[model samples]
Target: MTKKTLAFVVYPGISLLEFVGSRTLLGIILAQEGSPLKLGVDYELVVVGERIEEIPTDTPLSILPQKTFADVARPDALVVIGGGADTLLALEDTNLISYVRGAGECASWVAATSTGSLLLAAAGLLEGRLATTHWAYADRLQAYNVRYQATETSNTVTDGKFTTTAGASGAVDMALHLGAQLTNQATAQFGQLMIEYDPHPPFGRLDWTSFDQQRAILTPLMNRRPDRQDTVQDIAFLLYPGLTVFDLVGPLQVFSALHRIAPEFRLIVVAEQAGPVMTDIGVRMVPNCTFADLPHPDVFFVPGGTTPTLQAMSNPAIRQYIRSAAQHAQWIISVCTGALLLAAVGLLEGREVTTHWSFPRYLKDLGARYVQKRWTVNGNIVSAAGVSAGVDMALYLVSRLRNEETAHTVQWLIQYDPQPPFGGIDYQHLKLLPRCMRGIFTFVAPLYTTKARRLTRQERGRPPYDV
Candidate 1:
């Protein structure tokens, strides 16, 4: 069997969510066990950029492309990731446009998400084709002789071989549809379950009645370019293999918006090394700095996952770095089971914290009392409930760090207003799953707890890790 390559084109300032959301879904189909498909066997996923360098995203963290455009001129499929103003800027990049046009011409099918459709239109590929982009940028498609499909009617639009998606979140829907086309329905459904793509937006969908007014509010905010300040506070996010992409990206998107308007706030992703780290969903993310490079950031953030997170708890280097950084950090934050890592490090002992709903017992085993809430703040330590909750908690952090008005602007900028299709999670009916998970954690908890205890003893008499 020949392996088909799926190339995702990435550039500086591209929307991280739009890029990762789709890649994660599709990547999982290849990586997930028992799926019949295997990464590098049945399919290969690669992030393609102009050069194999660190390209910054709309968020603080940057992505490292696995291949250059020159390397993969003809892939099985091509996906162009979109962004805000920078996406508009990308339209003027002739080299990029040429690369996109040339590669897209030879690909089996070409796709774009959000404002990325404009890039396709710019390359003269979408002319006379029906397509969709971010609702905010949909009107611009008419200028290229492309018929626009309303996002209200459909999140993804397919006109012949060209596929386009509505917003950043729309990428997920697009990926699922494409995944099914590439494989089978069952394989795509399995991929969806692997990532837990079940979304429950707290608010319920956007109220389109006020679309014009909402658009008016966001246009100027997107255009504003504040001057960088001399003294900037560093907000560091931890990156590791197998960490949930949304857990890191959700809050990172919130803080990234805050950084745009409030230049004094800087966002950075730190890891054991400065290179590409594979996420749990099979997408690779690049960190800007090493742990030793930025040891004492103002704010230190940890994102959580499943088995890898438990494995991370026992890693001496990761544990020591968190322990050392927390000593001088003004704020320490965690999303999902990230709280478990902090608990393992002895930071959450007797502290009121919250984690993903499935791991309260694990949190308790590590010596922290779990409070069931979207987020909990005890002094400078803040822990959010689960994946999507990070966005809510980060907004609260923005309000605290800057001001209510600033946070409100950031919310509007990201269009954070949630309208889940099926409404919010009903914790009342979610008993059996957590009960089953507890039995599994029962066996897994002691292995890490004992190791954590041993690491703490070894570090007590010594100074912090050199990094």
Candidate 2:
């Protein structure tokens, strides 16, 4: 079969989730089996920028552009992504606007999400077209001479060849809609299942019961079904009460994209019970499997939280599970304070590791070198600092599991390039804060650690430290 190309137009400060969500959905369709088409064979993915250089996102990481507008003049589909104020400034680039116009004219599918519609409108592609953008930018859409969608739901409006969605969150909806339009509803459903795109957002209100019913029907169609080839590597994500959602999701999302490229990853969310595990942010993530049900995993990932994580560190069952899982696992990974769990289980002794910046001294107390890096690797153990750094660690693991090129492709698929809005606050800036503000944290930090130690001892049926 002849190959078709899909080009994602990116610029500095583009929303990573918007580009990642869309690319993942479409890539899953290409990864499906029933379809005679295959990614890199029947379909190609190209990340096009003004030039072949690194483009930063709203996060700290940056993506390497695969193609330049000078190279990919036209592709089967061209999606213009969007971001913060930088996206608006990117629209002023005459060459970028010209490229969008040229690509829209020739590409089979022309689409944009969030502020990307602004670029589409600037390119004159959304003229007289029904469209949408970020909810905050809905009023701004009218300034560009396009009909704005006022709804705040996850919906995509497609008028002829021009497709648009509300914001970064709606990109998946737009991608699935496009997938169904390109292939069929069944194929789109297959793609949706591949990425587990069922909407159960933390901050947003969603009918989880209805979503659960839908997943019951869709889970069988997902490539990660239990009955699939036993050789597939099982990557288990540990879920405990009150764990931080982003710490778990950051790496899990990276692995999800890798699954699209190679269906060898079996992602299982395992908890003590197969039910909703409340996160620190009040989001309840339902585990896919129970500790009793999950076999030994190839990769064991642990995410950390506050009181709950501290409490879990002393849970004999959880500690035993981690110890046993780490025994057979080729890679043992942790994010944020999740390293504390490893330390408590006697796994991090004499190893270089990192954790959330606020508590690095604890690692030294636990007999590990506190490396102040995004992520640290020592033999089979991988540790990432803070919340979002898990993305870097996971991508690095993907490189180890497959190859650097495959990891780069996965990174491009997710638009892994990052550029923080306010940027990082250095030690000097932090010291410039009010003395009372510094005193508050300093006074509270040890108290939290002391309370956690007390809770850990109580959970372990041991005497309190001071008592």
Candidate 3:
């Protein structure tokens, strides 16, 4: 098979999820270690735009293009992104439309997601093709002599070499389809499993009839972020063996919420390798990017797990990556005992931080001033107390990065208002528990540190490879 160049056409105010999700899913398939085909060997990936510059999106984040229209005169497959309705309507670049038409002539497959299909329509490539845009833009999609089709279960419509998908989530499905076309169904299935793409919503499907309720819930977030000049921050979350899922995902949920509103923040989950890493509780998480891929991040985040974190400190590569990334990072944040990793790398030296209540003394031993607060911030270093506290820290970070208004908007969207069934965490309430239950808590409390210490001591006398 011939080597193909997969290109993404990026623009200002484009939907980050639509663009990133498709590319990431495809990347996972291409870059899956041990696969017969490799990224640079079997295929080349490129992000193209009108110019080779950073394009700001509707969210707080900005995307950097790898190639310009002049550079990538033709690509085997191209992805044109879609954005807000008004933003898409305002985009009337003759040069861009002309390039799209010219590129489509030689491209084997031309695809668009959401309003991005409109660009293809505007370029006259969709004149006789059957396509689909976001459901809201179905009528407008027909204006270019394209047949607009909709289905309840599926979101993609493909005709010949042209494929268009509805909404942001449809990007994944479309990418999966493309993956199979590029490689094989088995490889695509493996990619899906690596990312754990199975969706299981807790509250079930939304009622389409309840338009008023749905509109009230979605309107604030659906509106385009007002234009502003800001820098994009690349945030990297460190993942390793035996990590606690909630420790990483807690703050991530908050950040993901903020990302929808203000995308100035980009989150990249990084690990030693490119594939799945198992957590302390046996849950597996696949890191989308690797340490080498994203070396210098603006924000370096670590989530704590007891056994793995201690083991991670002994690994020279983990220590080196954290140290190197820290040199360029504007902020270093941690959740739970993740503070230990930062401390291990000497980034937390003499800094005021916090950790899980069970390990405050351990944090103090590492030269950090342990404060018993929901979260602690000293200069550019921030630490959250245990797993649940990550959300508070993330919300606070959002406020610092953008504004209280933006943070509040994210908070409202996620419905962060807490109404815990057990009246929330309190040291006093612990004494009220039954003696039998207290025994169990006591047994579990020191398990993490004890196991970690054992591993550390065992490696003390041995050479690096003796393990």
Candidate 4:
């Protein structure tokens, strides 16, 4: 097999996380067993900068280049790291830009992260395509007249051969997309799977029953399942439980917010069980599930979490009960892991969907596509990842149910503004950043509040960036 070369080009004031984030993705993809891009086989990570001596890393540690931009062979993929506000011009050195111009002609993919796109734009890499960066530098980056729209979606933009990310976290999505392009879906899946895509709530999580796929596995609890019809105007979650604090609050609240602005389409938030739900931050909420017991509503909503109670709902009988209720419900919607329960009941087979990235394993184990995207709408079904993401997805859903005018208003209300105060790009790895900007805007932000993984002996000392 022809070996693939990945050249990570670094410069002064580079955002360290974006730089390391790119390499980490390529590293993770190669680390998986039997993956097409195996360690020591398909790819090699090369950090290239201008200096002949050791370079300063974005973090406190120092970084050494595998090769200099003035010397390395042309690569299959060329990645430019994000730089600081002032470094955009500092990185405008002719030697590096010359190499990039040549790579632009030879490399299969040209990727940039954060303000790194500014480098490419400076080198004339993004002449005609839409590009983005951290919203702050975005003003400066766009000063060059590049079309810069404020988009809060996931990364990996492909314009012919150029790819760019919005900001720091987007680097992961960009690299994964590049991985998919270099390899294949299954190869990409292999790497994603090795990252433990199967999600079990720290509390535990699940997927589906069996065929008679669409057949009911049990009796409906009330008048709702009396049996079918309606193409599905919209699906609203009408429950107090099974919602992640964010999803439970964000999606429903945002959807309601949209209605408050414009009332073209109808919305319903129902519940099978009634009570108060404590959100992720301890916020309390009382739901409107009375319809779940009345005439079967056209749309169905399953909230996230419900982790503590998912086991009870996992039964075939309960699955059948939900299946029967859904028989009349036009669309089934779940935000985050709530989609898994829908899948477990056989409602999401072969359907395009999404749940939070954190719930990858749950999405994968159920054979659901836990895409890094916010929302994936398949006919009759729509699912969203995380609670915050649910707002994005729901707004999209609201647009489809209502209109673009309404969606635009909702987007503005939420301030869908994403200029991170401390961009995470600087915290990724030592090798990726220039020493100049260390500690200014650190990525890999402090850590998740809770311990993400419980590593076994086999995993001891192994890198945990995958978590």
Candidate 5:
């Protein structure tokens, strides 16, 4: 039987997710979900150039070959990986440009990830086309006159034969989506389950409608972080001063005690103003209660999203006001990078704090003296790992505030059983990720360290801002 060919455009600085994700999914489908028997699907990564030439894979050691436009086998489809450096943006390779336009003119389908859409736009295939990429690259794509939807994730745009996804590993989603289309739902669902694609965000479905009220406070914050600009990394590292999860189905399921009681605690969303809070998932959240309208609660949580009101943090008057008010609040907890604000206000300092494990080393270097723990408690200040960690932290907080019985019951009511399909090693492809991302971590370390010390020094009345 003649097999359909899948050619992935592998360029420099392309996201590992796009290449690895798409390729892995195809391989999984063709290989038939770990079974001894095999299915049949032929997928290939063909980098475009003058002729067949070697292109750098996501990892430094791996090199994917480029197929010349003249001899390149007309693929059943094309998937262009993005997050490439600026050079790829200009697209000087006429062979690539020619091949894209020619193939797109002849082939039935074309797709792109993140900035890879720029290539489509460059090829003149996406003009007047509806597409999407990473939120950070929306404006860049818009400049090319491509219609943009900022909310799409992994791989999820299906505009006729031209599919586009926000690449960062979204290529994986695109891969699965393609596999599902080519094969069956069972394959796709099995793949999602196999890799534990399920998410347990502490916040609800994040979006503008959900966080409707907080738009007033959030718009400005979002404006300040148009690129996201490694804000989480910047915040975490500066606060940690590097830092750094898991599938635990052990005898003591972490929150097993919480599965036995009813929860009395209520959720309160605050903004120093009345309204919704935008979550990091590119959506806004409206908590059960608003802070301006509700009475001071026994526990306060700042969910990890974007940074809270810079006005709240930046203004000398507002900062002073919050410092005074927080003194009376029973518990002040920041999940994920939200601790950056807490520390900035002199709350988390002098107290051991914990956040998601991504920045453990940085946090300690920044003055947060602690090790790799899921939850960290320094008196009334509690911190947890990344977004999902909040579920456990929330239960733990319930247990401590109310009782173990209450926390346990709430856990049971919610059925908080986590079965990460990837298990103990979910995100273990360390070397496969692009250097740009790793460099973001490397660059952020010293920068945050400098910032943390400066903040400390300012508090100490030293040189005004140097620790």
Candidate 6:
């Protein structure tokens, strides 16, 4: 069978969540176990950029596209991602709009996520079509002669050939729907399961009573661009293959907003070597620099993963770097099981820390005091409970570093207001499960330790494990 190509348009200052979430779901077919579908065989996924150069995102991390607009002019499916002010700026780029218009016109499927629908409208593709975008910008669609749909209840809206989504989180829902259309419901469901797409927001559903009030307050701030400050403080994030993207992206997004308002706060992602690192999801991320490039930073950040994180605990080089970096960093932060990595390096000894609810015993075994909270701070060390908790912790960190007003501004910019479809986790009911899970980790620890030790002796040319 001839491979059908799906091209995702990427640009400067694009929202990472919208791009990553949609791409991860759509591309999961390649990673589905026992599936006949294969990359370059049944399907192909390409990141289409205006140029092949590294493009900055709304977050501190930048992305390197696999192809340029000139290289892949038209794909089977075209997905245009969105952003904040940068997206508004993208509408003015004649070259970009031309490419989107031409490619979108020819593609079998055309889709936009978050504010990306605005780009489709700018490209003159959504005229007389029903569309939706991030609620903040819903009113802007009518200017281009497009009928705007309220995304308050539905994350996605499809009008003929065009598919538009509400917010960054809606990208996942849109991708699943599109995936089902292109392949089968079974394929989409399998992909969703692979990524564990269950939604459980810590807070209850969002109240839409004040949509106009929020729109009025945030519209001007979205348009306002603060002058860059000369004074700088380096904030570094550690990157590794098989790590959870949300663990890093959640905090990174928060800090990115901080950087937007206060240029003095510089954000950087570092790895053992600089290049593409495949995430826990099927998506790939390219770090900004190498660990050796920035040995010491004002703030040192670490993200967590599943089995890979356990294996990382045994890597001597990683352990050494963390120990050395922690000595010099003014603040040390970990999200989810990243606390286990810090604990592995002996930096969390006697310190009150929190990690993913499932891994508190591991932290305690590694000689750290476990605190059951969304996030905890002890001296210069800070840790968050799990993946989503990183955002909450990061917002608090911003308040500490700058002020509550500054943090609040960043919160509003990202629409951090939580409105989970289902209420927060009921820990009381699951109390017995944690006790059972704690014992399982004891046996799981030594197995990964042995695997890591074996990996250390292997040739350095190959990756530690398949991402």
lDDT by residue (1-467, candidate 3, tens digit) is 45888778877777655665577677767765545565334667778888865576544334467778988988887888787554454358787788788888789889997778888999889998888876556677898888997634466788999998876556767777777777676677655543334332223222345544644655666554544437777888887878765567656656766776767777788888876676543324467677888888899778886657756655667766776787678888988888877776566768888876556655555556878677788888888876656766787888888887666656544433332211233443333223344355346544444443444455444433210
For candidate 4, lDDT tens digit of each residue in 96-121?
A: 77777787668887888767778787
Q: Could you give the candidate ranking by TM-score, starting with the highest?
A: 1, 6, 3, 2, 5, 4
RMSD of each: 3.9, 20.0, 13.1, 20.2, 17.2, 6.4
Q: Find the 10 residues in a row with the least total lDDT in model 4.
A: 199-208
lDDT of each: 0.79, 0.69, 0.67, 0.53, 0.48, 0.76
TM-score per prediction, in order, is 0.83, 0.51, 0.54, 0.42, 0.42, 0.76
State the lDDT of candidate 6 residue by residue for 1-467, as single tens digits.
56777899999989987787677778874445444454234667889888888788887677778888999987878999999778988988999999999999999889998889999999999999999887778778788999998766777789999999876557777887887776666666655544434443333234468666766766776766557678878899988878877778878987887776788888889888878887875556789877788777889889888888887887666765676677678899998899988887666878999887667767766778888788889999999887767777888899889987677667667655443322245554554434476568766766654443344345234332211
lDDT of 2 by residue, 80-137 (tens): 8877456777878999999999998998888887789998898888877899876446
Off by over 4 Å in 6: 34-42, 176-208, 230-233, 273-294, 306-311, 328-330, 349-380, 385-389, 399-408, 416-444, 450-467
Tens-digit per-residue lDDT, 1-467, candidate 1? 56788889988889887787788778866655555455335767888999988888887677778889999988888999988778888888998999989988888899998888999999999999999877667778779999998766457889989999876557777888788777666677655544444553334345668778878877776867768799989999999888987789988888888877888988888999877898875557788888989989899889898889988988877987898889889999999889988988888989999987667778777778998788899999999887767877888888889887777667667655443222345555544544576577767777777887677666676766657
Task: Report the alpha-carbon TM-score of model 2 versus the true structure.
Answer: 0.51
Q: Of the pair 2 and 3, which is ahead by TM-score? A: 3
Model 4 lDDT at residue 452: 17
**TM-score, cand. 3:** 0.54
Best model per TM-score: 1
Worst 10 residues of 2 by lDDT: 199-208
lDDT of 4: 0.53
Q: For candidate 2, what's the RMSD?
A: 20.0
Evaluated at residue 173, the lDDT of candidate 4 is 57
